[model samples]
Target: MTTNVLMTVPTGPGVGLTSVSVGLVRALEQQGLKASFFKPIAQPHPGDEGPDRSTAMVAQGSSLRPVEPIPLHEAERYLYNDNIDELMEEVVGRFQASVDNDSTIIVEGLAQIPGHPYATRLNKAIARTLDAGLVLVTAPNDMRVQDLEHHVEIAAGSYGGIKAHDVIGCILNKTIPGSLGAKSYGDQFARRPIFKRNFALLGQIPVAEELTYPRVKDVAEFLRARIINAGEMDTRRIQSYTLCARGVENVLEALRPGVLVFTPGDRTDVIMATAIAALNDIKIAALVLTGGYEPSAALIALCGKAMAKGLPILSVESNSWDTAIKMQSFNQEIPLDDKERILNVKEHIARCIDHDWINSFALNHEERKLSPPAFRYRLIEQARALNKRIVLPEGEEVRTIQAASICAERGIARCTLLGKEEEIRRIAQNNGIELNHGVEILDPDSIRERYVAPMVEIRKHKGLTDIVARELLQDQVVLGTMMLEQNHVDGLVSGAVHTTANTIRPALQLIKTSPDSSLVSSVFFMCLPDQVLVYGDCAINPDPSAEQLAEIAIQSADSARAFGIAPRVAMISYSTGGSGSGNDVEKVREATRIAQSRRPDLLIDGPLQYDAAIMEKVAQQKAPNSKVAGKATVFIFPDLNTGNTTYKAVQRSADVISIGPMLQGIRKPVNDLSRGALVDDIVYTIAITAIQAGSIGA
Candidate 1:
C-alpha cells in the first residue's frame, strides 16, 4: 500500500466510522508514527445545527489541527453545477491547508447517508485522486460468523473490488466481547478465507458500552431539565440510571459513579443519601427530582456542603416514570466537551488495534508524493518556526492588512505594517477583520525621515543626497526595504497597489544583490494540480546575457532546493537541443553550458522546448538522455517576457495557485506580490520571505 494517504471508509450501516477513525489515529501515534487527520467534506446531519460531528470529534482529540470540512451546501452546489473537478480541487485545497509533509494523513471518507446518493462515488473519486489506500471499517452488527466472508466480499465489491480499490484491510468495530464460538467474532474474522489469504484482519474493537453513554450535560440538554444546582454537570458521566422507588438504604448501593438517580423532590431521605455519596467522593452523574417537588430550605441547608463540592442536582416537570420514558430514545452521540470520555474511548479502541499492522502499514510513507498541500504546509511550518519579522509596505490595502493579521495570528512571522496605524485599522474594521496583536503598526510618515540618512549612506556612491533620500523614502516600499537593509526587519512584502518596479527598484538600490549573485531574478512556485514547479526569472531581469541567464538558472535551482523542492533545472526555450537555429535557442543552449560548468553538482540541463521539458512522452522522443527533461521541478525561462506570459497563462487557464515572484539574490528577503494578488497569495508571499530570511531544515 502507498501509505502516505489512508482513506478510512465505512463498509456499510452500523459502523462507528468516527470512533474507528479516532482509534486508528491514536494507534498510529502510539507506534510513534507522525500522523495527521483530515475530513475532506462535511456530512451535515439532518435536522441538526453546527459543524460536522465527525470533524468536531476527530479534531477535538487530534494532535494536528485539521481544517474544517467543506460545507455541505457549497459542495452540493458544485455538484449541482456538474463541477466535480472543482469540488475535488477545493477538497484538496482545504486538506492541504492543514496537512503536512512529515506525517501520513488519514482521511475519513464520507458516510453513505440518506438523501446523499453520490456518497460512494465521491468517496471512490477522493480516494483515487489522493492516491490513498482504503481501510474499510465494518461492525458485527447482526452479521453471523458465517456471513463474514460474504459481507467482506460485498463491501469490497462496492468500490470496484478489493484489488481495484487498493484495499489495505478491514477493521471490525464493536464486536461483542468474550464470545468463544467460531460462529461469533472470537476469531476476529481470521477464520474467514478472505482474511486468511486475500484480506487483512486489522482489528476487532469489543463492544464498550461506556463509549456510547451520554454525559450529564447531554442528558440535561436532551431532557431539557432545569438546574437546581449546576455543579460538575459537564464532567459527570451517565452510564446507568435508577429510580428511587425503594427505601433509602436499598438506593444507597445504586449511588455509585456514573449513575443517575430519579426521585421526588420531597424525598428527603433519597436526596440526603445521594448528597452523602457525593461527600464520600462518589461522583453520581446527577440527582434528578421529578414531579416538580422541591426539598425544604432546611434540607437544602443540610446538603449545602455537598452542593458546594460540585454535586449536580436537577429538576424535571414530569413524573419519574415519564422522565424514564422520555429518555428511552436518548441519543448517545459523544459531546465535544466530554474530554475524559473521548480519551477513554480512543484508548480502548487503540488498544484493540493491531499494533504490528500499523507500523508495517505505513512503513514506506516517505515515498509519498510531494503534493502542493504538502509543500505549502512545510513552507509555512518552517517560516513559523523561525519567527522572523516581515514588513508590508501596502499595509493599508485590504488584502495586505488581512494577510498581515493572518501571518501574525499564525505565528508565521512578526508583521510590521509601514502605513498609518489608524488607516490600517480602518481597513481591517471595514473588512470585518480583527487585526492581530503581533501586527505592529508603523506609520511611514513618522519613520520615513529616520531611514533617509541610512538610505543616503548606502547610495552615496551613486550621488544620492539627503533631499533625494527624503523624497525616495516617501515610497513605503522604499521605507520598508530600508528597514530590511538596516536589519530593522528580516524581510519585506509589497506591490498590492504598487507596480512591480516600484517594489523591486527600491530593494535593488538599498539592499542590493547578494555577494554571491551577479544580478537579481525572480521565481514563482507554481502549484500545479499534481506537483509544485518553480518558474524562474518570471518577475525580474527582462533581458539577460548568456552568463546572466546561467546565473539566474543556478540561483533559481538553489532557491528551489532551499524551499524543499528537489531542483531539476530545465532551461526553457522554443527549440530542443541542436534542433533549431535562432538567437533565443542559441542563447539558451550557451546558458545551459555555462550553468552546467558552474554547478556540476546540480541537475542543470537546457535548450529544451517547453513540451520536451515538462512532458515525459515528448522528452522520450526529443531529449531522451537529458536528466532534467520531462521531470523538472525548476523551469528557467530565457527571458522575462516569455517567463511572465507563460506563468500567467498557466495560472489562469488551468486554475493553478502560484506562490512567488520570490526575489533571488537580494541581500535580505524582499518579495513583490502581483497587483491582482488575493489575500492568501499575500500571506504565502510573507511566509516565503520569512523562510528566505532564515536557515531552513536546521
Candidate 2:
C-alpha cells in the first residue's frame, strides 16, 4: 500500500492541534473517506511535556487508528546530536509501518515551541522526506483579524508558496466568534475568497464557550483544598469565577450554574445567600473559602439542606487575595472522559471546514496518476478496428470540423461531414486543417433531395407529406438521422449547436429504439485520472417512474459492460439504506428492486448516498453487510434532475473530464455533444458513436 500523507503543521504551541486533528478525521469520515491520525513526536501535555494527550484523546475519541509518538526527549536528543537524517529515517520508517493503502494519513507535526528550537526545520524536512502534502493549522491568539493571514503567509513560505500543490490548505483553530474585527470570531465564513486571499481556508473553528470551563473535580484537585461537601464534584464544570467579598445582597444576583464563588468563611450572609439559591434549584457550582476561613458549626448545620442539594463547599488555607491569584492561573483544559464535548467539538469543527475542498483533495489523491483512462485507450482501439463511418450534423461548426479532421487523420472513424463541400473546405483551410483520406465532405444541399423520400416514408405514419419531409431535411440533424436510417452512415452525432431534443427528435422519427430495448436512455463516461465511471440517465430522463428507472438502470449497466467498465450498479439517492425516506428515496428503492429482479446477473444496490456508493469507509458504517455498496462503478440516478446536477458537480469539483450522453437503445448509434464541448470531446463522442455502432451488430 503506497501511503498518502497530509502533515498538519501547527503555527505555534497552542493551536488546538488535537481538536483540529479530531475534527479533520471526522470530516473525512463524514465524506466517507478513510483517514488515520499519527503524531510523529510527542508534544507537551498540559502542565507536563511528556506522554502526549492528543494521541490518546483522538485515539479514544474516533474509530480511526492513531499511531503513538516517540517521546519528545528521544526525538530532541537526535536533534541535539545533529543526526537529523537518522531522526527522519526513524520517523518515516515508523510512519510507513502503520500506513494503509488508499487511505489518507494525517501526521501532527511538532509545535513551534520554546523547547523545540529546530521544530520548524524538522517539520519541513520530515514532510519532504515523507513526500507529504502540508496543511497549516493556525490560531489567531493575539493577532487581530487583519493580521492573522500574515502568519499563514509566513509559515507557508517554509514549505512553499500558499498555492503550491503539496500545500493542501490551512485550518484556523481557536477563532473568536462575532463579526470581523469584533473582538474574537467574526465574519470568517467558509465562503469564496476565503481568508481575504487565495489562501485555502479549510475550516475556522469558533472558540467554544464550553471549553472555557474546567471540571469542578479538577478545580478541587488544583486548589488542594479539603472537599467538605463534594457535591457533583466529578460531574459539575465551573468557569466565570467571582471573588464574592461583597455582601450577600450584591453577590446573590450572580449565583448561577457554573459560577464559582470565593468569599470569607465568616461571611454567613454569602453562605446563606448561596443556600437560598441552591434550595431554589439554581444549580450553583461550588462555594470556596478564601484566607483559610471556615464557617462555624451553626453555619454548617444551617447549610445541611444546601449540601444535600449538591452545592460543594471547599475550605482553603491561603489568604483571599492569594487564593484568588492561584485560581486565576488555573487553566481550562479538556479531560479524557468528557466524551460528549469531544464529539460535539468534532462535529462543530467538521461543519466549519470547506467540505468541497476536502472532497476534491481526497479524489485527487485517489486518482493521482493523472493518466488517460484505460477505457479511453480501449475506445480508440475499438473504434479504429471497426472503421465505422461517423456522420457529424454540425460539420460547419469549427469544433466539429477539427474533430472530423482528427478522426480521419487517426483512422478513428471514416468521417462524413454533412455540409456544403466548398464551405467545409473553406472552414478547414481557414482553421489551418489539412483534411485528407477517410474524410467525405458532402454538400447537404445536394443530399437533401436524396433523404427527403426516405424521411417521408419513415414518418409517413405521423402524416404522409412530401412537402414536410423536404422542409425537415433542411435540418442537418434530421438529415443525419435519415442517412443513418438508410444505412448511408454507421452512426450519427450531433447537438454541438442543438438541444438534446433537437438531436433525439429526428432519431425518434426515423431510426428509433431497437427491438431489444423498451426505453432510450443516455450515459456520460466520466474520465477520472485513474479510471472511468458511467453516469446514466443524466441527459435523458427527467423523472422516470420506478419501472422505467429499473429499465434505465439495466440499460446503463449493459452499456457500461459494453464499454469495458465493470458494472456494479449503484442506485444513487439522497439517503443511504433506511436512513432517509420520501418519494425520492422510495423511487430509488423500487428501481433497485426491479432492476435486481429483472437482471439478476448484475450487481446492484440502492438508496445509497453519494459517499456510500464510492467510499468503502462510509459504506461500512452506513450500508454495511450489503453488496455493491462501496465498490459501485456504474451509478443509476433516480431521475435526470439528480443525475445531471450530481455529474456536473463531481466533474467540476474533482476536475474530471466527461464524454457523451451517448444515446443508448437506438437501433443505430446516435449521440449528442454538449454545446460547450471542446474539439477533443467531439472526437471522443465520435469514437463512442463508432463503438456503439459496433455494439449494434455484435
Residue-level lDDT of model 1, residues 13-73, one tens digit each, is 6588888887777776555566778898888655557766766665554445677889888
User: What is the model-wide C-alpha lDDT for candidate 1?
Assistant: 0.82
Q: Itemize residue pairs with steric clashes in candidate 2.
A: 176-184, 176-185, 177-185, 178-185, 178-186, 179-186, 180-187
Structural similarity to truth (TM-score) of each candidate? 0.55, 0.51
Least accurate 10 contiguous residues by lDDT in model 1: 365-374
Q: What TM-score does structure 1 among the candidates reach?
A: 0.55
For lDDT, the strongest prediction is 1
lDDT (Cα, tens digit) per residue for candidate 2, span 610-690:
899988999999988878888888898988888999899989998788898888877999999889998878988999999
Residue 5 shift from truth in candidate 1, angstroms = 8.5
lDDT of 2: 0.79
